[model samples]
Target: MTTSPTTTTLDAVLAGLMRRYSERVPDVQKVLDVMLDAGVIQSPDEIENDHIAFRTMGVPNLGLGSFEKIFLHLGYERRDEYNFVEKKLSAYWYSPPRPDLPRIFASELRVNELSADAQRIIHRYTDTVTSDPVDSLDLDDANAVDQFLHQPLWKTPTLADYQTLLNESEYAAWVIYNRYYLNHFTISVHNLKPGYNTIDEFVAFLQARGLRLNSAGGIIKVSPDGDLRQASTVAQMIDAEFADGAIFRIAGSYVEFAERRVLSPFQDLPADQITRQHRREGFETSNADKIFESTFTTQTGK
Candidate 1:
């Protein structure tokens, strides 16, 4: 199967877009203003209720369950969340691999000034260019077992290492359960209370306490149109049984289950065959509920 084209060429193009758009679209501060105008999400609600967090998948190192804990803390029922890195990100939300979860977990983003055309570009790129599995473990419940094996976290990352990953792996994660877009990076605004207009408001709130968040430094990207933005981060493949940093990138929490490290192969699959394999392996495309429910037993709660 085809490995992801070197991350440099693809990621560089996306990074340039991030820098250009950050200026056009407001950051956290501007997001607050827009939220007030649209009557969508509110300031207090963002901090207290709709608190959000995220993660990203690095190629070959599919960190699928990366942000399940974060989403759980926000009161998204753990059982309701899901992940996928096997197909297109949009496809997962549009048609989930798992049929159990509700759309409420799908954070409907409001691309404020984001042109419809720009949005299409973003989606099309991922659909056509990024729709392939880097590698996966061929074991039962592959994603689940791998997540347990590698608990990745470079928490004490030196500034040098932090900036390094940004250039190569622009990773992000979503909790949607659609097989087509499992482990895709999603920004679900629905987690917040109504009345907030834009997503920036919440972004600002997240930046307040100085928590480790997606930023311009590394593993993040902005779109070319100066309207939409995307960020990526790596999942530390940690396991007491495994060596420190013996990690592989993940798609959401799904680890590519294999006896050893390898890239996911579902990428080179024929379009029709991909679907057939999905069905043959009883490939679950959605798991929105399980992720949401994982939050309850998490330590992120106040």
Candidate 2:
């Protein structure tokens, strides 16, 4: 089968994301190493990426409105929308053009709903973006998009501003510094060999290997229908530099493990005959809510 230009570009874009994300999040390698050592997989390429997530600040010329365009232009179709009332967040999951590509979960903080002080601090940085930075990019040029994704959209935030945001919304503090950096890339456990193929089993493996697991609502977050279950590592702490040259340890990215069970209707189908569509799809708001805290101090501070 011939690969379309769009598919090729999407491959490069996803590859670039995973590359930098792995470097930033040590848990990614920690998980892979344990899996390899246990003979769960011989190579990293064998693991199926369920999806990757991004966090943004909902402000003019940025946030989901601006960030989603990169993947949308690459052929991703926007799916369901989720609202996190308590956290003041709105999100949408996009289905990839090709089944081989991991789905995208992009979320943004409802800046307007935040406290006045938090909004002022967020706008101070985001307001500099007079227009959507993504609008200026040639989405077809994989390299350009890769660089844009990693580039800073606003000025370096001061420690004072970061702390203010952190006190109000950890998510805001994260995006202010991380920008478009991939939040977490999920490993699909259902496809792995037995004993390491379920969220429970996979999470156990992670725990036994001495990797920290986010215990927000629970170690495993399951959907209402009990088909989509997920777990993630607490965000890694990195020594971040502030605008005034102040250094502080802040949360970075992490890795997530997911198990999308085969839908009831397709459970009887032969294992070899099953495909992506046969499994439960999309994300669950409840599960994602707790997953979001994977970066919160509640989880990281533990």
**Per-model RMSD to reference:** 20.6, 0.7
lDDT (C-alpha, whole model) for all candidates: 0.28, 0.93
Best by TM-score: 2
Q: Write model 2 residue lDDT over 175-221, tens digit each, in one string.
A: 99899899999999999998889888888888988999999999999
Clashing residue pair totals per candidate (backbone < 3 A): 75, 0
TM-score each candidate: 0.24, 0.99
Cα error, candidate 1, residue 131 (Å): 21
Off by over 4 Å in 2: none
Residue pairs whose backbone atoms clash in candidate 2: none
Residue-wise C-alpha lDDT for candidate 1, range 179-281, written one tens digit per residue = 1122222333323453322335444444453332333222123223222322322221211111234333222221111001012455565434433223211
User: Candidate 1: where is the Cα deviation over 4 Å?
Assistant: 1-185, 217-222, 231-240, 243-302
Residue 214 Cα positional deviation in candidate 2, in Å, after optimal superposition: 0.5
